[model samples]
Target: MTTYLPKDVTDGLHAARKQDMARKSRLRVEADGRSFAVLRRWQGGFAVDASVVPPLRGLVDLFEGSSPIASCLIIAAEAEDGEMHYEFKRATAMRHSAPLDFQKDDDAPVALIGQ
Candidate 1:
């Protein structure tokens, strides 16, 4: 059985705490062309500290560049650390589906039959 020195134990604890804090580092989250700093990231989705804008209840499309990556709904919001903790889910976009176009193009060339 190996014995760890007191200083070594303290250093190990400090290192573990620092790693945990790093996991909670600020992350950028964009929605509707606006970006917010997220406080923490977990499985499924992340949490944002929205102290500037009032939290709203509805579905929001989160985008990366010009393409949308996630569709999240504002599930819960609470006041914490002088800010609103907005939690969202990485859910699918619930919208009406567009009807399929079945009309053929007039400019299309027809293939020769039995040629």
Candidate 2:
């Protein structure tokens, strides 16, 4: 005989799976001093747990652990399946400075073998 799980049980399982994936992801979102785990991300948009924060809009920052990844303008937000998906009006990547070794002082004189 074939058997199927109840709707609530299946929903719970799906929610658990989403939570697990978010926990494992290094990506996170920050807005108004609040941080939320990213459920999914792409070039145009991202998703976060709806239970954590209220509906998001306007500017928000994306981060990979402690590093800033991008500045996104959330033009739209939709909540579904316990997750809030945001569509960005614009997503600008953060610029990082070069390593100390890679940077050179142009005014500094070069060393010579014999002077």
Candidate 3:
């Protein structure tokens, strides 16, 4: 026979699971100047709370805290469990330039030792 959990117990479990997801998620999406916390992410897609973000499509920026992670072209994939899922059509990682030190010049020419 199958057993069912009490309503309160099931609700508590759901709340706990949602909290865990939020805690583990560090990525956020920025679209149209609005930011929304990512609920879950994978190699090809991500999910966010439907209540927090409006219908979004096209290019969006993903960030880990203040650092940019990638630029993605996302298309609405589905909505379920209060979350909106998006599939990435394309994703490009943000590139950073190497730090330069003006005090040292390794390319400078040196005189011959014994000419």
Which candidate number would show the highest lDDT if scored against the true structure?
A: 3
Badly placed stretches (over 4 Å) of model 1 are 1-35, 64-67, 93-115
lDDT of each model, Cα atoms only?
A: 0.57, 0.86, 0.88
Q: Write candidate 2's Cα lDDT for 1-115 as tens digits.
A: 7689999999999988987988899999898999888989887798887777678889999999999999988965678888888898988889897547666888877886776
Clash pairs, model 2 backbone = none
Candidates by lDDT, descending order: 3, 2, 1
What TM-score, computed on C-alpha atoms, does each candidate reach?
0.40, 0.78, 0.74
Regions of model 2 farther than 4 Å from truth: 1-3, 98-115
> Whose TM-score is greatest here?
2
State the lDDT of candidate 3 residue by residue for 4-61, as single tens digits.
9999998788677766787788899999999888989999999987876899999999
Residue 92 error, candidate 1, Å: 2.0
Error of 2 at 94 (Å): 0.4
Query: Which model, 2 or 3, shows the larger lDDT?
Result: 3
The global Cα lDDT (0 to 1) of model 1 is 0.57
Error of 1 at 21 (Å): 11
